[model samples]
Target: MAFVEGTGDEFILTCFVCKNPFGLVAQFCGYCQATRQQALGVERARASQQIISDEPEPQPVHNISSEVNTPAAERVKKQKPKRQNLFFQNMRLRLDNFKEWQIKRSKPIGATASALFIAFTYVVIQTYIFVNTAPTLDAEKYLYPAVTHEVSYFDASNSEPATAKTDIFPVKYLKWSASSSDRWTTKASWNGWTGKADITFTPAGNLETDRPVLAQFTAQYSTYWKVFRKITWEPASPAAILKLSYPNDKNLTIYFNGLAAGSISNPAVAAGSYQMYPGPFEIKFYNLNTGRLIDKYTRTYFISTSGVFSPSYQN
Candidate 1:
């Protein structure tokens, strides 16, 4: 490199870049306009471009066997089970939190849950006890079977059956048979329960015929139902009843089961109406003025629970 200023002289140098003669300047070649450093860089670039590169270029690293064995879709498939397991675990944790919250809500909530559990346990225990209790073949009246059944009866020489209406649900049919003088039985079976209806009669005597009477029927159970049954024992009705009108009270005296009931003539004779139970009663006729008994007859009779004794026997 050379420099000149205001010397009134012309000088020249050969350009290293273009190989042309150049006028003297401070830094650049005049012919090719290249600096010293630029010329060096261009020469190095040309030299490198001319050289033959025998070595291969670098590439990304990968396992060819692993890529072949495990495809992208198959790897994604393998990860699904793990994700599902995590989901289930999260759900269980949420459920546990919910359970804790419910139990901790209030005293009433806990108490209600405990009460329900206790009731269930009590019912289970009672069921076990009832089933395990002595198999005494106790009698039970199943309301469902009886309610669904329509029964007919013939009492005291009656020819026709009791009801004129047909059966609502004729799911069962049983033949009636006389078991004894005062009792009748029927063969009936339903819903895993099998038994006969044992009906007892009250010796019913007539108020009009005096010697003739209709039988009062009473039904009884034959077997115990030990499963899922609600039972309530009902009292048996009176076997007989006697009704006496007013004004005729003075002439009649009634006895129920050998016990003196009241006189129709008496002011306190149950308002001139005398009803009795157990049957086999006595009716005595008397004279009001003489206090002398005119006639007396003892007989056995009864009536239905809601019906008065009217001697309904027909033979």
Candidate 2:
């Protein structure tokens, strides 16, 4: 290369490495950008070596393969395997040639599975509702203790507060398979409880017909009024009793298993007509037994047109 004598302008040289336009001329043709960069590096190394002449160094030869190890460059040069969607193509081909029996059978199989699933669900739901809502025999077995429920009040002016004028309670009767004369009863002890009415009766007499037993209390108008609504008279345990209340002395009709037991007649029951003091009535039931009497229930009754309305209300 020769420089012009009068012109001070520098000549722009094309890159020999990649055959691209560059500022200075070089020994290597830079046909590729990476090769041009390598030529520039070699020139810089030569200049640095000339500056440090005291250091021992070997002269480097121009070898294209020794410039840089680029896996991407190797991949660009090498061939790549072609991709194929053979799995999807095969599935579509098989579906086109699928048998009629296989396709039709799938519907019934799906329907059967769905039906079985629905049936299983319904069974589970039904079981849950039955277990939770329905009464269990185990609980009924344990609830056999006799109890007496009482509700009554005495006038502050007339009698003692401890004594009730009338008691209203429910009764249960159990039939015993025996002769007419034989009978069994337990003492009227509370089922370990002071107030509700409950009893367990075992029949010693003939159960073919209703049995009649005497009650120590009398059933009056005022005694039948109160406890008619609040009673749960489930006739499960053999025999139970109801105590009646009264403001005045009166005759009471008694029923044993719906049969007439005995009526109590009194004359002092007439004075309770116009007295507004609690209407005067109480109720209770007792078991007539040889050893001990089982007191089933103790309840207070209120007067109503239909009947007593305390422990239970029945027209």
lDDT on C-alpha atoms for all candidate structures: 0.37, 0.33
Please report, as a residue range, the 10-residue window in candidate 2 with the lowest summed lDDT: 214-223
RMSD in Å for all candidates: 17.3, 23.5
| Residue-level error in angstroms, candidate 2, position 186 | 23
Candidate 1, superposed: residue stretches over 4 Å from native? 1-97, 103-112, 124-183, 186-240, 244-302, 305-315
Q: Which lDDT tens digits does candidate 1 get at residues 1-315? A: 455554422445544555555555436555456664443334422322332233353355899898789867766443343345888899999999999988778798878889999989867765564344321222122111221222322111122232212122112111111111232122222211111222222222222322222222222333344534322222233222344433334465544333445565553234323232222333344455675664333333433222344322111
Cα deviation of 252, candidate 1, in Å: 18
Q: What is the lDDT of candidate 2?
A: 0.33
Give the least accurate 10-residue stretch of model 1, judged by summed lDDT.
Answer: 170-179
Give each model a TM-score: 0.26, 0.20
| Model 2 Cα shift for residue 198 (angstroms) | 21
